[model samples]
Structure formats: C-alpha cells, structure tokens
Target chain A: MSKLCFVTTGATAPFTALIEAILSRPSLDALLECHVTHAFVQYGTAKDVYETSAKAAREYLRQQGKETQLEIDGMDFDSSGLREQFKLVQDTKGLVVSHAGSGSILEALRFQVPLIVVPNTVLLDNHQEELAMAMDRQNYLIHGNISNLAPAIKASEEFRNKMSQFPPVTAGKERQTKSFARIMDETVGFTDFNNE
Target chain B: MLPACPALYTTTFLLATLATLLVAATLRLLTILPHTRSTPPPPRRRPGTLTRVLIVLGSGGHTHEMLALLRDLDPRRYTHRTWVVSSGDAFSASRAVAFETALAEKASRDTGEGKEEAGRWHVGPQYYTVVEIPRARRVHQSLLTTPVSAVHTLLRSLTLLYRSEGLPDLILTNGPGTACIVVLAVLVLKFFDLRGAQSRGKCKTVYVESFARVRGLSFSGKLVGRFVDRLVVQWEGLEGVSGGRAEYWGVLV
Candidate 1:
C-alpha cells in the first residue's frame, strides 16, 4: 500500500520541462513530506531527460539521508492508455501530476484521485493553459507551474478532501441540462414516450 | 449564310445568366445551412427501432473526448455504428472496437439470466464497422500538397456517405479535421438530396466542441459550427459562441 505519484507528459510531444520540474529536489522533498513512497514518470520520448533528472533528485535525497524513503522510476509511453497507472493511484489514495492535455486530464479526473495539471507553454496558441486555469478554478484540479511543481505537490495533501466530482451530476437544472445521449436522441427526433 | 450570333454568347445574356445562377446558389444555400435553414419536423422514431449513427474520431485528445461523450450510448437505439477514422490512426480504430466490446459485455450482464433479451441490445460484430479515410493534412505536410490530400479525403468521404446502408440517421463528431471533411461530404449529399439524405432527414449532425476547450472553439469547431444541426460546448463560458448556436450542456464529457 505504497503512496504513488504518477506523472504523464502526453503521448505525442515530450514535455521535458515537466519531467525536470517534477523530479526537481524541492518537488521530491515535498512528496516525501507527504509520505509518498514511490514516484513514476511517463516521459514519452524524453527518456534521457527523465533519467538525468531522476539521478540528480535521488543524489540530493541521499545527501539529506532520506534516499531510502522514496524510490523514483520512469517509463517511455504506454500504448494501452494509462488506466493501470491511474488505477494504482486510486487504490493507493495517491496523486496524479500530468501535462494539461485534455485526454489525460479527462482520464485522471474519473478515478477521483487528486490531480495536478502542468500545461506546456512552449507550444503556439496553447489553449492548455486556459483549460487548466478554468478546471483549477472549479477545484477539479490544481494548475501547477512548470517552473516549480513543489507548491502543487505541497497542496495535493490538503486538496484531496475537498476535490469536486468529475462529470458533475446536474443539480436543480437536471432535467434541463441534457446529457450527450439525450442530445443524440433528440437530434434524431426520438423523445421518450412520456415526453410528448 | 452568315451565322447569326446566338443569344447564349451575347454579353448581356451571359451576365444575366450569371446573376441568376448566383442568386439561385445563394437561395439554395439558405435552404440547407443550419442557422438560416428551416428545420423540417423530425419523423417519429420509436425506441428499439433500427438506427445507424456515424461517429468521427481523430487522434488522441479528440478521440478520447468523443468516447467519453458517448459513454451512455444505448446500443438498443443506435444499433448500427459507423466509426470514421483518419488513415494511419490505429489507436482510434482499436478504441472503437474496445468500446463496442464493452457495450456487448454490458448488455450481456444486464440480461445475464434472460438470454433472449440479451440479443436485442447486443453490439455484435455486424452491428458496427470502422471506416478509415486518408488524412486531410498530415503533420509537417507541405501546405502546397495539403489541398491535394484534403480533396482526396473529401472524395473518399463522399463515397463513404453514399455507400453506407442508405444514409446514417445521425452524425456525431467532436471538432476534428477529418470530421469537418465528413460533415462537408454530408452537406454535399444533402445539397443534392442524394439518396434522400435531406428529404428523409438523414445525416443530422451534432458536433461537440472538445471538453478541453474551456475558453473558445477549436479550428475545426469554428468551421463545422455553422453547419451542424447542433453545436454543443461543455463549459458555460463558451455557451454563446458561433453566434449563440453553441449549446451549453454542462461538461458533457
């Protein structure tokens, strides 16, 4: 029952900055402070960057005499999606730190694990920043800065208790807020028998 | 005998014909375009009726969101599925198959004891088919050659729409480049009333802007927004986009 922090940097473009930021010494200290024992990074074609970052972070921990407390690992990409990785996080009541790619955000939220989203700002016309801010404002996730992930790592501890649900259940306007299924049915003119 | 100048070649006549043709095309466009077009009353469709739906899937992000949006799909209603993917997109194709397999398993679970009822809503192999067309524009593809590939995609889309079992009753997509081409092909079919696509109210399209779009629509969203029967956005901030045609459905994905 080891606490795990799963970090994914998307599948296409490699966000080496995110890998370095998460594995930074300060971020590792924050994780250890929160009792996190294992850290897994999905580097996605940035193996060298992940390796170098992990080595530096581990050496830093060794100097502080906390090297045996936390273990760090890395992997290329997972072709079958990251379901297994997210499931481990859920079972361990751990955290998911991911690039603010919509695909990973949507997947991680469903597992009800506290998530920290770090958007890659180098890409032109990056809407990932907007999405991260909006989702963060709603308390769906924490928007982590690429320059320093230590703050987000520290926040993950207190954030777990009050996290909002994903695919939110419609409240007072439940009847009016149509699900995608109903929209599909209505677009084709199929109303349930009683609706007419 | 000197040949009399024909009326067809006369400058005034040609100009008048050109004007008339322009007016006719405009009028035709008004009759079919989503916002300006008159929506005919939809025909009655009962539950359990055999219906076909076309789903357009793109690379990673769009494909994932589209699947989440369809999580509650009732196999009993949408009996036949046509999954459209861009060429070389093996991930999307495999995900579609997995979705169908999951649906079949769920159907069986719901009717575990009642074998007869299981067959009714079961998503068997024959119930869904995946069709792949050429990419509209590949990554790093020269801009000069983009039109060539785009036209190729469009032509294949036309064949896909026409060759399906009659026309699909519904088209579901989430703003992918290839999805835009398919919607364009559907418009072409409806324009010509090919196979009663328009007259029969077939190919009714619903385009969902990606869940990731919190602030605005994507490039494909902007292009397909005006033409789709319904344009849905997940976030409330984007409710009034595309001249208020975008419907805010409260984070559908």
Candidate 2:
C-alpha cells in the first residue's frame, strides 16, 4: 500500500485544479511505484464532470502504461465523516497533500503528519492562504500553490524531519486556560457560586 | 417649557401615565405567569461546589478556537460542562467529543491511573454533554424565513436549558448567528424563571470575537457584543474600536 495520501476536501467548492494537477504530473509513473493511494474528494463537483475527469485520468494512465490506484469521491462525504477520513490519513503515515482549510490543517497537525497545503484561490476570501502562510511560518507545513505540488511533495522528507522534532500542536496550553479562568473568576465571580 | 394649552398637557400626561402603567403591568404579568411552567430549583450547592458551564461551539474556525480556549479549563473546577452546537454542524459536535476524549485521556495519563482499564469504556469523574440546536439562519438561505428559523431555534434552546438537570451558571460563546439566538433564549429563560429557582444568578454570557476579525467585529459579534456580560477580542488593537467593552485577551487560539 502506498503511504502517500492526497486529500482535497473542498466541501464548499470543487478543487478540480488540485486533482488535475496531481493526475497530470509527469512523474505519475514514479509515484505509482510508491503505491500511493491518491484519495481525492471532488466535493461540490457535478457527477458527470467528476466521472469524465476520472475517466480521462485513467486513460492517461493507460497510455503511460501505469497502473491506476485512485480513490475518487464526490460531494457525499462532509464534515460528519471528517474523523473517519482523518483516520485514513493517520493510518497511511505518509505525506498529506491537502487544501488549506483550518479543520484539515488542524487534523493533519494533530497526527504530526508531514503536510503540504495548497490554498484554493477561487474561494471568496483569501483566509485559506492566510492560514497556510501562518502554518508555514510555524514550520508546521509546506504551503505551496497547486502548480508547485510536485516540488512540495519532493520536499516532504525534509518537512517530515522538521515535524518529528516539533512538538504536537495541541488545543492550547493549560496555563492559557487557567489565566482565562482567573479572569472569569474576577469578572463574573465564576468561582464564587461554585463554592459549596 | 409649559404646554400652550393646559387641557392638552393634562390629556397628554394622563395618556402617557396610562401607557406606562399598562406596559409595566404587562411585563409584571409576563414574569409572574410565564407561558412555560417553571421547574423546581435544584438543591443549592454549598460554596466551592462544581459550576455547570455551557459552551457554544460554532463551526470551523470558531470550533477550533473554542477548543483551544477550553484546553486548559480545570476539569476539577468545572465538573459539569455542556456543549451546544448548531444543527447540521456535526463538525463542531465531533470536535467537542474529540476534545473531551482527549481531556479525559490526558487526565488519566497525568494521574497514572486507568492504565489497566484502558480500551474499556471508563466514565471519568467529569461530566460533559453535547446538545444540538437549530441554526438561526442558513447561509444563502432566504431572509424571509429567518425569523421563523430563529424562533424555532430559540424555542429549542429554551427547552434544552429548561430540561437539563441543572441550569448552566455560565454560558460562553464565540459569535456566529446561532450564538445570538442561544443567548437570547438564555436571557429570556433567566427573566421568565423558566429554569426554576436555580436560575437565580443569571447565567453570565461571554462572547469571544473570532480571531479572524482583527480589524473589526463580525456581524454576529456586533449584534450581541454589547448585550453579553464580557466581550473578548484577541487583538489588542480592537480594544479602542469596541469602546472599552471588548477586553483584549491576547491570542486565544
């Protein structure tokens, strides 16, 4: 089984750009040898378009004499099944190539997985880009555009080394919460009524 | 200044007094005879007892930030915790569950206990509950039906608070449309004695502005910003902009 997993969970919009970029890579044959499981969620994409795209990708693979190992999904899977999908990412223990959604980034970070974030510029706000850049600044993940997907993947080994030394990103430290609680105590007398 | 006509002044004064009295009487009646019958108050907790807390979870970034805020809350201090999420927002619900699970695991690990009981379903000493209520308004949804949905959600939130074994002492939220309705419902419940005598101390509402809104307040934040007991902004720059209502909390998430 290939350890590398490429996830494109574009719940609000289809990330066809990411999928096409991954499939059209010249080094598809090299990746095939790694047995990479290219799991792509074509969320919000029309069924016909997805099918046509997948079929074309498969034909391209056939022409290149490369075996296809692609798991493509439509928009059926949503937030409800996020944990289950994240389990797949963890099980793979490979590099994660994902769209720059906070939820996705957090999940990948939770597992300390080497990640390459590709921001979808088509979104109304550039918030994803911001999140990606911030995470990149933290050395948590490689933030790359779709066009740079190949280089991003190639840099995963180095990214993984950095991730290994980095402590897992938890929700926040206990001190932060304790401080907030103290403020709550003084402002709202939160602890006053609790005494019994 | 004296009115030009004494008769006109007298008539206007009389009418105003009558209207004021009528409104006051109506308000008193509403409180005294609420439509929903109040439940009996729970046994009063002695001083230093556990405080029941209700936290609202908004989807995506809000949920992420809230989880961060909750990460260090002393489980021993807050023994009872209820999480409320908007309907159809399984993402937030799942994140809440995951957070609780992580917290429980960490507690067990810290105490060097539950090692033998690992892999078994072990209910910890803490109490955590997750409840879902309808969304006040759906995105891209028609505004015409927003009032109906908002009212429906408010009613559901009211019922949830009323039915809970104990009413929450504090309600915390990061503003989204759903939090607005939930806060309103809680305020109404407090005013009407819908949650029984245990609701004596009005549940303190805390609204934390989303980290994304560094320059300005979100629409939902703007709506309930003033009404909440405490309005928190992560950025120091927002302090002046919020007219001193928003306390700078630094980066929470």
Candidate 3:
C-alpha cells in the first residue's frame, strides 16, 4: 500500500482555504509524485461547501487525465475510527496537514507524524496562528498559510528529520499524569493510607 | 444596725462575683493571646483514604486538559471516578469512554498475561461513570432565563450526587460554567447537613484554572476561587492576583 496523508479541519469550523489549496492542481501533482499514494480530507462542519469543492477538483483532475486518489469527508470520523486513522498515519509513516487547534496538533504530534499546520484565518483572536508559529519555532512542524501550501509540503522533509529529535507528545502526557497522581495522593492523605 | 447574718451573706456574694469575673477575663485573655503571636501553628493533617473523585469536563479544550490530568492519576488510588459534563456534549462523553477503553487496554498489556486474564480486566464496568446535566447557561440563551437553567442544573447535580453509592470524596474542575452548578450543589448539601440534618461525607472541591488564563482568572475560576478547597493556577503571576488563595502548580496541560 502507498503512504497516506491525512488532512482535518477539526469538528466545528471550516478550513476551505486549506482544502482548496491542497487540492489545487500543482499541489496534487506534487503529492502524487513525491509524497502520498492516498489522501484523506475531513472537511468538518462545512460539508456541503467542501463537497462541491471536492467535486470540482475531481472533475478538473479527470479532465487533465490525472488519476484521482483523494477520499474526502464532510465531517470528522467516529472516535474509534479516528483513532484507527491516526494509527494508519503512524503505520504508513505518512504526514498530516491540520488546522492549528491544540487537540488536532497534539494528537498528530503524539503519533510523531511530520505535520504541516495552516491556521484558519477566519478564527477569532489569531490564536491558531500563534499556536502554529510556536510549534514551528520548536521545529516540531511546518507552519504556513493557504497561500504557501506547496512550499510547506516541500518543508516536510525537514519536518520529518526534526521529528526524530522532538519528543512524543505522549511522554508529556505520561509525566503530567504521574505528577497529577502524586498530587492526588498527597492531597487526599493517601500516602499513609497506602502504606497501611 | 443591720442584722449581722444578712450583711455577711451580701459581702460574701459580692466577693465571689468579683473573683469569678476576674478569672473568666484571665482565661479569655489566655486563649486570645496565642493567636496574636506572629507564627501560627501548622495545620492539622487529615487522614487519607481511597477517594471517590468527580471530574468535571467542559467541551473541547477543557475536556482535553482534564484528560491529561486524569491520565496522571493512579487508577488504584481513586477507587471510583465519575466524569461530569454538560448535556448535549456528546464529544466529551465519547472521549471519556475512549480514554477508559485505552486505559483498560494498557492495563491488560502491562499484565502480559494470556487472553483469559486480559478478558478478566475487560469484564465489568470500567472505573468511571459519565454524568451529564443541563448546561447552566446555553449559548444565546436569554439572560433572564439563565437563573432558571442554573437552578435546574444544580438540582440535577444534587440528585446525581445523592444517587451515587457514596458522596464524592473530592470534586475536580478546570474552569467551566457547568462546574459552578456542581460546586453549588455540594455546598447546598453541606449547608443542609450543617443544620442538624443527615450527614453527607465532606466533598472537597479543587479548581485548576486553565493554562490559557495567563493574565487573569476566567469567570468561572473567579466565581469558585473563594469556595473551592484549592484554587490552583498554572502561572506564578496569578497567585498574587488570586488574593494568595491560588497556588501556582505549574502547567497541567
């Protein structure tokens, strides 16, 4: 099986700009040739709009005599199913392009997948952009806008290398979990109780 | 001349009253003086026991943060865990269930036993219960109706708590509007018990302010600040602003 690339826009918002940029002819040709054998795009709360865009992209690809290899969903996958998809990403040594929501970024990072984060500009407060930039600064991922989608994909080679040095997000979770347990033990007076 | 017996009785009574007054004043001063000293005695230690922990999860970011904290808690230490969320938040509920499943899988993996033993771990309800109550204030809900919704939520929370096998030993929250109702429910129960009613186990509240609140406390954090057993802020600067009640615990998320 060919390598996979997963793209998601979270559950609540639409990132059509990211979707459009990724499905643009040049990006598709580059991805098909150099990167992924299959692509899964989860459009999230903007199903109808994304479906229309996906149809147009497919038609354009067919007219250009290029084989279509994209699977698009209007919304997110089921919880269990999404977990399996992440597992696929890990298994295939694939990449992820995601909106800069903390949950999405962290989940992708947990699998140690090379990531490209495009902040949805429509979001309030520029929070997503800030998060994306910070992660980029740490060399954990490539941060870009929809305008520079192809270059960000090109940067994935560097991102994959940087990922080896970057610690798995699960390590942080495990450490925090241990500290939290200790706090609970101390707070609840369980230390002495456990000894007995 | 007055009768000698009457005069003697009157004098004895006067002297006794004066002596009693002086002794009472001295005792009061003795008790009050110790507190006036600069250094206070260390707080008494509470007896620790396996606790029932109730974790309140808000949608999205709040739920994610709480999950990270929960992952760190030793499951054996908290014999019973209950997750509370607002009604209509199916995402949080699903995530809670998924986390429990993953935990069970991890436990089985650690045992390194046969399939039969792993099946044993999977048997029975996992260590947690998810309880959903009406939101205190729905998005775009009328301000006038908010109190009604809040009261409804409090009543539901109280019932949920009462129906549980035992009162929660502790309640953990991370700045959600729904948490206010749960905290209120606990306080209301405590209030009734205080008035010579049936005793419910003392349920302590620990509110961890979200890490995003760098400059100030969120509205829910501010509301529960005075009431929670511990107000934990992740940022050091917040301690000064929280009237010294908020303890800086470093970043939890």
The DockQ of each candidate is 0.75, 0.14, 0.15
> In model 2, which runs have C-alpha deviations exceeding 4 angstroms?
A10-17, A26-51, A65-93, A146-196, B1-7, B14-48, B59-76, B87-132, B151-166, B185-201, B211-216, B232-241, B244-253
Rank order (by lDDT, best first): 1, 3, 2
What are the iRMS values of all candidates? 1.3, 6.8, 5.2
Flag regions of model 3 displaced more than 4 Å. Answer: A14-17, A25-34, A62-65, A68-76, A146-148, A163-178, A192-196, B1-50, B97-123, B126-128, B162-164, B187-201, B209-219, B222-227, B231-253
Worst 10-residue lDDT window, candidate 3 chain A: A168-177
The DockQ assigned to candidate 2 is 0.14
Query: What is candidate 2's lDDT per residue for A1-196, written digit by digit as tens?
Result: 6565656545656677776665555435434544555645534554555566667767777776664574444444464535555566667766667777665666566677778888888877775786677667768789877775666766776677776322332346442322456545544354343322
Indicate the docking level reached by candidate 1: medium
Top DockQ hit? 1
The number of the candidate with the highest lDDT is 1
Q: What would the per-residue lDDT of candidate 1 be over residues A96-185, giving only the tens digit for each residue?
A: 999998989999999999999999989886799999999899899999999988989999989999899987877866446777888888
**Native contacts matched by each model:** 0.80, 0.08, 0.15
DockQ of candidate 1, scored on C-alphas against the true complex (2 decimals)? 0.75
TM-score of each: 0.93, 0.65, 0.71
Instruction: Order candidates by TM-score, high to low.
Output: 1, 3, 2
What tens-digit string does per-residue lDDT give for candidate 1 at B196-252?
997788899989998888888999999999999988998888887998788886878
